[model samples]
Target: MIDLARQQLAHDADPLVVKVGTRCLTLPDGTLDECQVESIAEQLVRIGAGTTRRVVLVSSGAVGAGIGLLKLPERPTDLPSLQAAAAVGQCHLMESYNRAFQEHGLLAAQVLLTADDINDRRRYLNFRNAIRALFEYGAIPIVNENDTVRTAELSRTVGDNDQLAAMVTNALRAPLLVILTDVDGLYDGDPADESSQVIGMVEAIDESTTGFAVVGTHKSGPVLSKGGMLSKLQAASIATHAGESVILANGRSPNILVDLMAGEPLGTLIPGQGGRLAERKRWIGSAAMPIGALTLDAGAVEAVAERGKSLLPIGIKAITGIFDKGDLVSLIDEAGVEIARGLTNYDSSDLGKIMGQPSEAIADILGRAPYSVAVHRNDLALVRDAEGS
Candidate 1:
């Protein structure tokens, strides 16, 4: 069945995202391997040149490379030190990429980005346009997290290049995202167990898939970088939910990229959401983090999910957490299941007074004029289920 799906999804014309992990690019001694870099460069050039195919390479290895350059004993713990390492290593890393691409008569463009690029609508569009333009110029983009200055700007977790690549795949609407990693693919259980088998095709990365797969990984302390099987799974979930496929394969294997393009099925193939959500909705449902949550009555739940209506004050049973107007909030049901997420029109305090009231009553309760609805239909998007997929 996985084979049949692979054959059906063999879209050579669809743009591909090739994310090279630190493990693939670093040596056993915790240094950047020139051989691996050269090998990757050759593979990328082979994929991009002599065809109209466009490839986005989300490469990870900056920090590891930095450690070797600075002769550090282990990974740095301080944010400032990590940024310094990123600044130093990013230069040498790109230089290696440039030289390697040149050998195959191709050009490699370095694109440094932060989570803000994806969170901000305008900036995200600009980044998307730049990638498209790179394709027109017949150049492959080497994307990496802007680790140097992102700490202060992004409040969420740090160093998840796997998730970044997934976002890039969604932004480009690429049919496939190949996460080149150290492992062969996702196994049914622990790889060391003989009973565990590599699951072939994943239609949806829901609880079943995630439960069966490992979420965190570390071996012999830190080797090259922080990306593990769990990070890849998170990335796969994001991309697959956004209507994209993901391939997790062993980067150490020769011609892996070529084989995948040929539909050889060398990795675990995770299928995308059956249909594409509007780009704006994908951004809203994903990209931005929810600052707060709103609990809704059964009526409000029906209105939002079944009738495709905006959330109103009368339907909201309670408001939890602090949130301001124009901020994103999760709309949950009485059972505490998240049905949807959306940008709220009123702050939590304001909504608290307006809860269980009619739209016209909002103005009288809040003193100031209020938006007609608590959450406009245009600003709302459905969550997959109670787990908030």
Candidate 2:
């Protein structure tokens, strides 16, 4: 049984996002380690089984798994070659997950997303709704960044699964974000040197530990298997500020997920602010990529941040970049600080006409009111201070 305080903390926690790293899923030789993957899946099944808790897995190792299956010498550096490996590996990765989950009588659903999928408001809503439906059906959603289609040039790059998991946690409003890697947890110094100690229970991630070694081998001077420990910290910071907790642990440990859920001391824990973001508001704040930004006057900023009111067009003193209706955009104050992010119902063109206009005059100015609130409260996510900076 979990401690009452811990249980309440977990229950009232933000959404949980678990990112499975390549090193955790693959052997040192870069092969799919079925035993390890299966073990991790079983643990997850135990945590989500017969509970209201929802789990969103952000996984890597498609390329590595594929390379092993295809007998490739190493991870390809070229985009086309990398895409080819991802194409083959994504299938194998899903198959392994499906087989493992079946042993626990759980079904796994593959949900591949690219940066573009989350950048477009329509697609973002569609993706979110689909994943929600999958959970409702008692199936585990296996999420991966769509590597086969993603390009370096894409405007909406998640960069690594760590960042992706953070975004997913925000999207699902998960109470926790678990990052399972090869290492035990974040360390105070280089654990490889045997002089370092594991840093447990981080209230916040900060510069004191920013230079710690991430758990992975690099071909080119610490390129990081994908996003590395730095990225994980960055993601954790985002999730925690959104009122979600985060944990970084080793996936190889037996019953890891179950133990963590039960508040066992197994890894580093980053606590969350004990509050929940409203559903629609969470979606607006987290979903989609911000294509543009709205600069507000000081008064407007105060009203939105302190008064908890919807953003009106009158507050918008200036706009930057071109954006379509329903696009995710950033709300910046006079200092160019991102106060919030949300889905805009009106396009930049429409907004230009309505800027400084009253909400009541929206219909008269545009022939019809797209929405009463320029950026509805439900569609906004307030920014918090950076964690582990």
TM-score (all chains, Cα) for each model: 0.90, 0.81
Which regions of candidate 1 are displaced past 4 Å?
A: 1-4, 152-159, 215-218, 221-223, 317-323, 334-337, 368-370, 385-389
Q: What is the lDDT of candidate 2?
A: 0.78
User: For residues 167-254, could you state the per-residue lDDT of candidate 1 as single tens digits?
Assistant: 8888888888899988788878777667777776766666767666653233654655877787788888777776778889989999
Q: CA lDDT of each candidate?
A: 0.80, 0.78
lDDT, model 1: 0.80
Evaluated with TM-score, which candidate comes out highest? Answer: 1
What ranges in model 2 sit over 4 Å off?
A: 1-4, 7-17, 48-55, 120-122, 205-224, 297-299, 309-318, 333-336, 349-379, 386-389
lDDT of 2 by residue, 1-389 (tens): 45565566655543456789888888877788999889888888777667777777788989888888788777778889888889999999999999999998888899999988766657777888898998789788889999999997766687778878877887777777889987788887655657767777787666654556443222332122566677778777677777788889988877787777787766788787547566566555654568899988887888887777779999998988898888888899877888888778799999998988888999999999868777887667776344331
Distance from true location, Cα of 373 in model 1, Å = 1.4
